[model samples]
Target: MSEVQQARPTLLYVDDEDMARKYFARAVGSEYEVLLAASAEEAIATLATDGARIAVLVTDFRMPGRDGGELLREVAQLYPQIVRILVTAYADKDMLLQTVNSGEVFRILEKPLSVAQVREVLRLAGERHRERALRQHRLMAIDETLAFLAHELNTPLAAIANFARGIESRVAGEYTEQRQGEIGQAASAMHDNAQYCLAVLSSFLQSVRNSAGSKAARPEPGAEVSAGALVASLLDTYPFSGDQRQWVQVEMHGDFPVQTLPNCVALVLSSVMSNALRALAGTPSPALRFVVVAQPHLEIHISDNGPGIPPEVMERLLVDPVTTHASAGGSGLGMIFCNRVMQSFGGGIRIASASGAGTTVTLDFPSFKNRMIRSDR
Candidate 1:
């Protein structure tokens, strides 16, 4: 294909009527490479094959099998990057409002769809798609930089602390014993400070990667650790502010092994826990609960008693995310990255919240058939 052909963004138009499909394909073929599907099923199949090339999905709402609203919902959940538009002949105000809000659709085009309207909608959608692509590229670049910083600083920092210990040990003698002991304590403090700094850096960097990383490679399943141990490690390592540690209550219903890297799990938990903590801020009698369950499948529930998420904002967390605190440099990538991690591990994450009721985030791990029970060490 020529550069011009490749430059033109692709748009998928779904309609049950044959004439309508042809009309749309003919109408907007000049600006966008139009792909047509007869029904929701055919549209899904086309996306399965050509989704990477497609930027916009425009569908006729009334159809035989699955309606356009249903397809839009599915696409929003699965391929969130693709922009969605609903073209309906009969627009029920309530239904349209609900569908558009829930799906985070780009636009709603009423039937008798004019060529001008279609062109304008596609133009806007194309612009949005391009902007998102650029933003995603930038986020990935930032993540690469963070990774490099972490890699370069970690080893040398550890070596410096180790060398400090040796220096403290070598200066020990009868005259210098007291001085050497004080020096040794200083070395220990240095090590602790360095380690603490590294831990905080890792947590902050990991949080960004969790939200910004669009395409992180899946690592092979690593060694397993007990849920209790994992949770304890997370809570222990997490840097809590004065009196914030007192707010958390950890409970273990049952213990089971989780087959995933501890760091990956910790990062995922950190993102959600960060969100919960932000919500809990300034709330009276703020409470944070971390619970583990080892039943049909291992589950970690992080619940906070705070002002709950709004309906529109909660819906967008997975479908179309935007951080509640943009002024505070929130990227709104938390749930998206978390969901990707869960999917990578053949598991899933569930977020349940209401307006007045607090939010609960549940990380659901897939079950493994080979089960081993280990006595506590």
Candidate 2:
């Protein structure tokens, strides 16, 4: 084996015939650490002792006592991360169909396997194994980073907020009318900005907690929420300046009440609004219309007359992080986060857009009646 292949995990090759097993191992032994087993029973014994170190399993379809199909089923249930491949000399249509339906086998190899063919299959299998490992590693790293940031940033943020409030109070009582007017404006602005920063920080911390597998902070159970009131409050506190605030118009069609985690709902809506604002930047007479319809279920439609999402971006927008404006510090996590939040509440989000036309994001929530019953229980 080459030095690089020696560092990789062992690949097990199983067959009922000793000659077949030796021949198969000889073909691939130079490129991989090959372990040979004469039957399914022996293969199971080898796996029991060294399954964790086995990267791939190749077994013959026909075997005495236990078959390859049964062995693959057992391996799939126990070591699902391990890559499995089946090799057969005979063509049994029904057996092939059964194996495919079980979904345990990654790839099926016909009998008379060539060195080149087995080498290529093993290469693909190794790639899949490495990709799965990388994805899991990244997810763990993200969770750890989020937890550390939430813990480290919470105390300093609180201290800053308190100091800003203290300055505002002192400026109010310790100055004359003229002096107070000058200093109070600055103090008030500091306090307002601090509060906004704290709000955003809190939202992000909650998201971190959720990602770390803890239940998100929510309102009291059975507490009724007014959809219109919530929307109005979010808009009023949203950081909008000058005519930009006036560009957003809200229309309420009917009264909608729901029982859910208010903070989670707010986070989802805030993310949507933030994305809309970013999209509308630098557009002429940029307009945003928020329409709430509340009959069968509550639906919020956020429409913007800005350059719509590009076709390439829209394709993997929700599936993966595809950013259009990375220079502007877009992380491409807004829509993905919103989708997760909606899924937590058994709700969903849909987006529609074209090249020149505007974009529309629709958030759908469960009916109040259904949610109320769930909350009550």
What candidate 1 gets wrong by more than 4 Å, as runs, is: 1-6, 174-178, 200-377
Cα lDDT tens digits, model 2, 262-353, are 45666677677767766787899899998998866688889999899999999888879877756444668778878887877678899999
Cα displacement (angstroms), candidate 2, residue 229, comes to 35
TM-score for every candidate vs. truth?
0.58, 0.44
lDDT of model 2 at position 259: 42
Candidate 1 lDDT, 100-188, residue by residue in tens:
55645899998788999989988899898888678656645655676678768877777866787676667777336678777777776
RMSD of 2: 13.8
Q: Could you tell me how far off, in angstroms, the CA of residue 77 lies in candidate 2 after the best superposition?
A: 3.7
Report how far off residue 337 is in candidate 1 (Å).
Answer: 19
Total clashing pairs for each candidate:
0, 0
Q: In candidate 1, which residue pairs clash?
A: none
Give the runs in model 2 whose Cα sits over 4 Å from its true position.
1-9, 39-45, 154-377
Q: Which candidate leads the pack in TM-score?
A: 1
